[model samples]
Target: MTSLTSPTSGANRPARLGVQIAPQHAPYEKIRDTLTEVEALGADIAFNWDHFFPLSGDPDGLHFESWTMLAAWAEQTTTIQLGALVNCNSYRNADLQADMARTIDHISGGRFIFGTGAGWFERDYDEYGYEFGTPGSRLNALDDSLNRIEARWGKINPPPVHDIPVLIGGGGEKKTLRIVAQHADIWHSFGDPQVLEHKLGVLGEWCDKVGRDMSEIEISTELKTRTVEQADQLYDLGARLFTLGVSGPAYDLAPATDWLAWRDSKNA
Candidate 1:
């Protein structure tokens, strides 16, 4: 992989802070409140997970569909960019996903990000009647879907207002990272610094093989702990989008605020 130290201007930089608000634990009003508060507090993005049932303990817990919730978030929050942390590629057809993203992009006045991934969560696929293939097969499907999504975007009547950033979440070194290098504008991975460093190396290697510049792909990770030092470490490793997840009705904003403050401090 190309080992350039600094990111290119106009796209890459020190990571921006964002928050993922789980829609399964809260009412619509609560979700809206959290989005508004996060955007007001200077979050660069607000995200929701895509799933029909709770991935946690109870399967029957309150949940909302991802695309629909994103449509609402698009209309509700004026400033913050909004998207699914990673929409499951198995859940929707490629053309349909492209159309949905395009619509939401316009709804947000060009503040929509198209975050997607190879489907996981066996329960989601089985319960939803989607084909739950092996990891490699799912990656193949994801790769195909991404191609279709791009092609469909070109064919759509009104193109997306902006070239909506595509965020792909996963750390599979072989296939997933290769896909990230080829397709993702942003790649989201979940792990500690050591792990992320290793994956970033692998991702870079994939970029090299594909003749893609690693610096062009933004690195993102979930912020399990809210600490300035941890954020700094991630920044040092070339991660430019730090994300923290909060499950609601409790809608805790402490971590989100802390990270946002750290982002502002860096920019300051």
Candidate 2:
């Protein structure tokens, strides 16, 4: 695992907002329109979750694949960086994920963020016929796959248009944080300020052991139920990228609009 700091990580980076368009319980046209709308609303990143079924409401509601939609989103939006909020590593081969990301990177004119995770959803594996291994085994697999993914990116023909930024999601202290300290350009977590503060301390210890600078990994967190004031606590702790999750038929972006204004105010 490489310990070099990512070029994109910095304390001076402006606070940025991302929106995760849940691709469930709605038609693809609805999803497509939501993507464009968020970009026009000035979101810094547009994301979709990798799930085989709806996480809420109906169990068999209308749904779509993640990376495929990301490819479409790449062409649909001209500015917003596109990727799965957290692509399931168990769903695809590591090399294929890298190549697919590179292809989309080209298609989007270098606007891509490779956000991935060890994948915890059991249904996605059971329904898709992937091995529903133990969490430790899955995490170990993720650690190995990331190395291969990075290696594949180097050897692929024509090469990636840019050093595709890697955004990893999870808050596990033992393995996940180690992985982030080694490879991530952006580290996204779902913890509250108290949880994040403690976990980040662990991450710093891991970084010290691996000879990585914790500051070289941009801190990210979800704004699922957080107010700007609540988010301010995280911002004070160094989180620069905030993601809001909008789901289903309506895909309400009013909250995102407010957050975008907050982001602009922070940057200013």
Candidate 3:
């Protein structure tokens, strides 16, 4: 794990907004349009999930690959930071992933967030001809892969524009938090204030064990199941990045606009 914290993810940074435009159940044009509109609407980050099929919707619904879309997004957007909500490490080689991330970072001029985790989608592995290993095995593999990724980044040609902030998304107390403490510049997970507080305490212990300043990691959570008041509570509990999940079809911005307004108010 490289000590790759971004100035934008540090304690001094403001509460940032991220939107995950789920690349499912929609045409490429619609997804691209939604992404363009999301950046225009003042999102600090834009994310897509790394899944081979729709997690919801019609089982075999329209879906797109994550990394390829990210490459396109690097060329498409200007200011918004881009990444997968959580890329599954089992699907790609560790060093290859690092190279791809570095390339996208250059294309986006240093605005790529490397969000990743151990894979959980059994179907993704089964369908893609990958071995669906046990949970513990997958996590151990993720642990190894991240170290390789960070090391590879250091050796890349015309190196990454920045240190390349790492965002680890998961709430598993034992393995995941330890990894986040060791590697992540941003720790994203699902929790209410109380849950988040507990997890933060656990993560703090891990940080202490790893000789890291807990404050060095920004707290991130999805806003899908949380209200504005609840989000305010999460903020009080130290969550600074709020992400809203966006999908195809209409890809409406009513909720995103509301949250962005709330973010500005808090930042103000």
Tell me which residue pairs clash in candidate 3: none
Task: Give the alpha carbon lDDT tens digit for every residue of 1-268 in model 3.
Answer: 1222222223466899999999999999999999999999999999999999999889799999999999999999999999999899999999999999999999999999999999999999999999988988988999999999999988889799998999999988889999999999999979667777778888988988999988889989989978777887777777789999988777888899999999999889
Instruction: List ranges where model 2 is wrong by over 4 Å.
Output: 1-10
Q: For candidate 1, what is the lDDT?
A: 0.85
Number of clashes recorded per candidate: 1, 0, 0
After superposition on all CA atoms, what RMSD does each candidate show versus the true structure?
Answer: 2.9, 4.6, 4.9
Candidate 2 overall Cα lDDT vs. reference?
0.89
Worst 10 contiguous positions by lDDT, candidate 3: 1-10
TM-score of each: 0.93, 0.95, 0.95
For residue 1, give model 3's deviation from the true position in Å.
36
Q: Model 1, stretches more than 4 Å misplaced?
A: 1-14
